[model samples]
Target: MQVFVFDWTAYSENVDKFRENGKMIRLGKKHFNAKTAVDTYKNHAEAWQELERYGFDGVAINEHHGTPFGLGNSPNLMAAALSQLTERIKILVYANLLPIHEPLRLAEEIAMLDCMTGGRFICGVGRGAPREYKIFNVPMSESRGRFNEAFEVMRRAWTEDSFSFDGEFYKFDDVSIWPRPVQEPYPPIWVPLTGSKESIEWAAAHDAAITPGVFPGPMREDTIRYFAECQARYGRKVDPNKISIMVDCYVADSKEQAVDEYGSHLMYLFNTLLRYDQVWQEDVKKKGYYSSTAFEHLRNGAKGTLAEDDTVFNEWSMDTVRAAAENMPLGTADEIVERIIAECDDAGANNVLLVCNRGDIPHDMYLNQIRRIGEEVLPRLQAHNVTFVPHAQFEQAAS
Candidate 1:
């Protein structure tokens, strides 16, 4: 039951500027303001401080490229900023897009952050969104191979004093990186996967933690179960703590108040800021980018615009969204606690990543929501023994 907070610190204000045009790379220079960009980071730091104060086990930042959905073009940079600003809680980047990065440089930066933070970093990695491939100009067809190779290289780089590696995308000779991570072997490597069998198998073989990113409760449970099946096939035992699930959440004095204050922001987040429309599918398919089994499942019954597929936007009713949210723990503090317990029990997941801010939710209101959860919900959850355990501990023992 170790709980963490996640936010993209998105440039939500710029939604109107790019939503219609559907051009992400162009949106940066034409629409982004330097001051506003700086402010976004500053604001994220400020909000993270509040999360730290609320006693979250960790604060998770996500990476997104060429999109107004998030400003964390470099989640490592955000992790660096948070390293200096907070203490005690882990700083998770969920995650860095491994395919698009130079592996050696990325590995060194992560090592530096881990050492500098005194082992408060959790390295979360992924293949990344389809649009990210188009934006970064990385071949989507090679994404899984690239991610696998990059991860293998980084692991060797972090653990070996001096290493040489030759891989399809990255190569090095007798290279020794300075500032080895403080964590033994390395800090936890969390692989947040949707539906790639290769990715799931890789994570299981490495004993890395796995999470069902942004999937709903039932889907998340199914994914975790699938991961366990993979682990068993590989002769590995599944640890529930390594199976985390994400939920969009807020807590208030009453269910009604929670909905009234948080409903619109949640709706705006799903419908506009986080919308995955037909454009993404067309581009990824056209370019042969890494395909997601999860996305395919989501698109199964779609007739038009995969966007119209079971999204809150397609439902187009607060009642619909609220019903779904309620199932995932979005209501009063008591209700949230109960829902979270039930959801975790069903999924056999011990870690929960909660998203509290999105789509112009006022900073003050978000802080208040955090305060309420911290004071009311968290204390109750303590009975469940929600604690943070590094994935390295599990991997080290298995090794």
Candidate 2:
């Protein structure tokens, strides 16, 4: 399968030293230094170049606003920087949250990036985090509708010379984006498929690529299968290479080494960084912001957890960490290769997104881990019928 690195650019330099006692992660800015944030941008660019040198098909970035969990408040900014840095690897912005953006502006920005990268950009779209919607003063209830409408505008803007749109969320009269994307039929659109059936169906209907994110157990595999099912209904071919599976990954000399170094950092992130702002959650609940299916899935995922607990540090245990790492390729090089292949075989996943660093892991450790995976795991993966097909090729095939 084609391999990608999902860089969170997590600001993990001094979190333990600065966090307020009993407060959740990303809650405050006591530890967040402006200088460090600037330094992180440099680090991310350097790391991406190293990943490209080590042989990754692409590097994916995501947007997270008002949180130190990810500094990519605007992933397009990172994409712009990387476009100048790297020449070969694909730049997958696994979504620019549509609800938070002006679609026409986003369309031109992406088109500019596509041209800058010589057609190496793959656009990924999503509804965004509920917390971000609140932070941006957007009503979460309109997320899906806004996302659908924005995507249509973006697509037409990329393809048409001059187009007018009248939609519920956006209206444009005879507007055209300059410097259309280099890729024919515009750069391919990928969707980050969480637990949204509607999103999965929509992606398939539009012949967009699907990247299934980390969910509880069989749900990830089930989601990929569901994508195939949706494609069948739409009479579209299911492309394994475009079906990406994202997982939390760390590898070292031994399983113990990997666990001891990365395990607690990972646990800290899931426990602290991933904890939705309680106020935001409550507001969403009061407003019924989530779709019924999305809400049900969230409820199911939080069952018996300390989602409501005040003691944030005590929220997770080794049991939970190990359970979460079960499906992940988290051991040595050999172990990682084995698990990855088996997973791709089971889920029909031909693309993988590896989150190589999180929390307070050292930069050297992250680079070393990526080096080993590249030297050992990637060569083996290449033998397994995995190759990236260009977005333009897919467009040509359809035409």
Model 2 spans > 4 angstroms off:
25-31, 276-283, 293-314, 322-327, 386-399
Q: What is the lDDT of residue 22 in candidate 1?
A: 48
In the range 1-399, model 1's lDDT, one tens digit per residue, is 688888888874645445555432335476777787777777778878988888888889989866667888888888888888888888988988899888888889999999878999999988887667767777888988899899988989898989998888888999988889999889898987665556666787888888763554334444455556667767766777777777767887767777788787766676666663324554555555534442333223222222233433352358866686656567778788887776666555688887878776766776777788788887676557434223323433545
lDDT of 2: 0.75
TM-score against native, each model: 0.86, 0.88
Q: Name the TM-score of candidate 2.
A: 0.88
- What value does the lDDT take at residue 305 in candidate 1? 21
lDDT of 2 by residue, 1-399 (tens): 688888888875645554467565554655568888877788778889998898789999999987667888889989999999999999999889999899999999999999999999999998886777778898877888898999999999988889999999999999988989999899988887766667777888899888764532445545555666667677665777777777667777877777777888887676666663534444555654555565233334433222223323346677766765666678788888888776666555688888878865667887887788789887787678744323323333544
Q: Which numbered prediction scores highest in TM-score against the true structure?
A: 2
lDDT at residue 398 of model 1 (Cα atoms): 48
